[model samples]
Target chain A: MRGAVMHAPGDVRVEDRPMPTIVEPTDAIIRIAATCVCGSDLWPYRGLEPVAAPQPMGHEYVGVVTEIGEAVREIRVGDFVVGSFFSSDNTCEICLAGYQTHCVHRGPGAASGGQAQYTRVPLADGTLVATPGQPDADLVPSLLAASDVLGTGWFAAVAAEVGPGKTVAVVGDGAVGLLGVLAAKQLGAERIIAMSRHADRQALAREFGATDIVTERGDEGVARIKELTGGLGAHSVIEAVGTQESMMQAIRATRPGGHVGYVGVSHDVSLPGLELFFSGVHLHGGPAPVRRFLPDLIDRIWRREIDPGKVFDLVLPLEEAAAAYRAMDERRAIKVLLTV
Target chain B: MRGAVMHAPGDVRVEDRPMPTIVEPTDAIIRIAATCVCGSDLWPYRGLEPVAAPQPMGHEYVGVVTEIGEAVREIRVGDFVVGSFFSSDNTCEICLAGYQTHCVHRGPGAASGGQAQYTRVPLADGTLVATPGQPDADLVPSLLAASDVLGTGWFAAVAAEVGPGKTVAVVGDGAVGLLGVLAAKQLGAERIIAMSRHADRQALAREFGATDIVTERGDEGVARIKELTGGLGAHSVIEAVGTQESMMQAIRATRPGGHVGYVGVSHDVSLPGLELFFSGVHLHGGPAPVRRFLPDLIDRIWRREIDPGKVFDLVLPLEEAAAAYRAMDERRAIKVLLTV
Candidate 1:
């Protein structure tokens, strides 16, 4: 089997590796049908996060289950499935509470890594949600989107409490942020504000349901959001960028008592306790519990109620994985899908 | 009118100040019946916040409406009222959305100090929630509690979503934290964990409905909370202390997808964005919008349903406001009431 591995920053290579096997009773081996380079992958690729050894490069995938361990009951061989970045035992108290990302039994699931030809999905019954049937080729990207970005965006919108009669502001133009616009709209937000400077991304944002666009950043962007929200800030704010400035912008752009659902993978950002305390905003975000939303997202995608797959503007063969990483790192692609 | 003023750090004096009068069309002048030194007042007294001049030193009070401006409608002269630290025009979009603390028309209401014998309440119609009628003397302390501490504690519980079948951990043992225990119980929390070292405060917490008391602090406290919750943190955590350690403890003690409602006046606390983002905890706090809960709190106090005023361990005549501040500063009292 061959899989993407990073020896060092900006040094992605597709190397032959031993095939994965079900090592645990609850594990399932999935033959990768589709996978993609995630925005978070850039953290290590750009040398922001040190890669001590060659590491698996992706965590979003839609695949067909090839084998299952004895304990795996719900998932079986020859079934199409979408799994979250983290594997969770759905029966755990935490998973039952809808936060499968922090499943106590497995810790955070991201450490497992999902960018490979044959991936072992632990807690298969809980971590993987199967589609109603074999999805069409056109539905693959959207289902893959549900594996992370779309579900994450949906969680961000839900966490922000976006709904009818509310104005929502999104901070970031990445695939997740773009999908957040779609989520907010689908969730019934009356007004959607997308903060983006790129012409192409901004156009996609509008098409996805952003009623307003602010090109400014930081305090200026917050001010613009406030102006649009009648000086009170938006009713809901989606923080899809995890930088300090973006977090602060999301917090500042939300009205007092409003919700700020942040889904960005955070980096060196530190929030001032006093400022956050005084802001009077509800804050919730982390490795999104994508498993919690996968079922609904898959259903929505199947019904054509949403088209989040449009976020993947570039697609490459799995052998060209290095190019896919470069496209995302250089901002050439919002998201890149790799055909396995 | 006499008021407690902070001339500088460690220097508090009871001095004659100009009587407050209606300044805004919506303002009302209140003859304070009771005022108290708050934990936040110690911030400036200890020089955590700068005190440039002799600043009026209190923001919590229960008073009798003595006069009302032309625009004041809901509150009438002679009405006994309890108001939040910040006056808000509750009809504004922000206020209607339950964020009166950020009402655009009135701005942050901290500028109107409630310590003076006669204090002018801006946005009288929105800020002051009157009791059903003039209450007996015995209920004054409880009503005063509702003016800030109790309301804040209630807000914390609400923000944390404390309710039936939930385990609630309170991070502070101060007046507000102690009241949080009561709030959690009233909201139907099955188990309330009060983290405190002070024996007196601990006893009070238990009396107020803490099902368990952990004397540990910092990481040890978090461990105890996890141990109590079967290795998963509590479902709801009330952060009544705003220090970094307390905030971190609150965060660490919450289960993934749990809620942390912090109402303590945040001081030198810095939250690492990545840790908070990965924790999967919902964080919401601020100077609590006490006005939003004032009516219900006052009603509960009037009906003798809950006794939050027990947090005030010492009482003094208004002329001895200096001693009241000293007692609270010296840790001899959890809270001090100054009777006018």
Candidate 2:
């Protein structure tokens, strides 16, 4: 099988790799249909994060089950499925409470890079959600999105408490942030403010239900949000960028007693205890529990109620994984789809 | 009139001061029945915080209304009342959202030292809640407690989402944390863990409805809490100490979906964003909109349903404030009541 491997920062190559076998009793092997380059991937590709050693890349995936371990009762071969980034027992107290990502018996859902011919999925029944029958070709990308970005954006909206009559501000322009606009609109937020300096991203943000746009960054961006919301700031703020500036902007852009749902994967950010204390805002976010919302999301995608797959702007064959990484790292693509 | 003023870190003196007057139309003057040295007071008294100038000391009080400005309508002269630390319009959107401490038209409720013969209270109609009636001599201290500590503790418990069948862990043994135990019990929490090493404080915690006790601090305390909760952590954790260690312990002791309600005044703490993000706990707190809980807290104290006044272990005349500060600074007293 061919897999994308990064030997060091700024180095990615598609090469032949060994076939993955089910090592866990509750595992299943899936033949990959499609996978994508995630914004998080850029952290290491750009050398912002340390690359300890050569490692496989890719977590978001959609595929058809090719084989199943004897203990895997729910998932069977030939069934098309979307899998969350993290696997869990699905019956732990944390998983039952909608925090499957923090389950007591959690496993890396994607043991082998999904940007390959085949991959091993642990806790198959708990990690993979079968599509309502085989999804149409046009629905593949959207279903693949349900495995990560769409579900993550949905969790951000839910954590922000975006609801009817709320004024929501989003602080990122990546695929996740654009999809957050869609989620906020779906959640009934009255006004959606997208803070983006890029024209193309702004257009997509608007198309995804952003009612307003502020092309400012940092303190200026927070000021724009406050000015737009009668000087009280937004009722909900979604932080999709993990940088220190974006985190501060998100926290400062929310009204007292409002919620700030941050999904940015914090990096080098130290929140001053004094300012956060005086802000009087609720803070809740971390790794998204995508598994919890996979079923509903798949249903919505199948019904064509949402078209989130548009986030992908570049598409290529699995052998062109290096080009996909380059396009994303250089901001030439919002997200790149790799067909396996 | 006489007031307590801190001229330096270890210097507190009770000296003659001009009588307070209602300066704003929303102001009221009150003849204090009693006031107490708070746990926060020790910060500056022990030089943890700089004594910028000869500032008046005290932000909590229960007293009889002496005079009122023309706009003060809801409260009457000679009525006994309990007041919050921060004054607010009580009509602003923030206040309506139960965040009165962050009110748009907020003012310092204790304009004059509350540990004085008489003090000025801003936004009288919003900050002062008249008790059902004048209470017997024995109820004075308890009613005073409701003005700040009890109200603060109640807000912390509310922020932590304490409810029926929830397990609560309190991370401070001060008056506010002790009262948090009481508030949790009143809110129907199933198990209350008080983290305190002092025997006297532990006894008070037990009296306030602590079901268990953990004497360990920092990581060990978090470990003990995890052991008690089947290694998943508690459902709700109340943080009443503002130190870095206490904050981290509180966050670590809460389960992934649990809440951390912090009310201690932050001094020099900075929370590492990565750990907080990965903790997956809901964090909500700040100066603790005590005014939001004042009415209910007063009712409970008035009905003799709780005895929060027991937190005050030392009683002294206003002239002995220096000794009172020293006692609290040296940990010789849990709290010291300053009788006018």
Best of the candidates, lDDT: 2
Candidate 2 overall Cα lDDT vs. reference?
0.92
Question: What is the C-alpha lDDT profile of model 2 across A29-101, one tens digit per residue?
Answer: 9999999999888899989899998889889999999999999988889999999999988898999999999
Best by DockQ: 1
- The lDDT of model 1 is 0.89
TM-score of each: 0.97, 0.98
The CA lDDT at B127 in model 2 is 91
lDDT of 1 by residue, B112-166 (tens): 4667787888888888888999989989999999888998899999999999999
Worst 10 residues of 1 chain B by lDDT: B106-115
Across A311-330, the per-residue lDDT of candidate 1 in tens digits comes to: 99999989999999999999
DockQ of each: 0.89, 0.88
Off by over 4 Å in 1: A107-113, B107-113
Residue B340 CA displacement from its true place in model 2, Å = 1.4
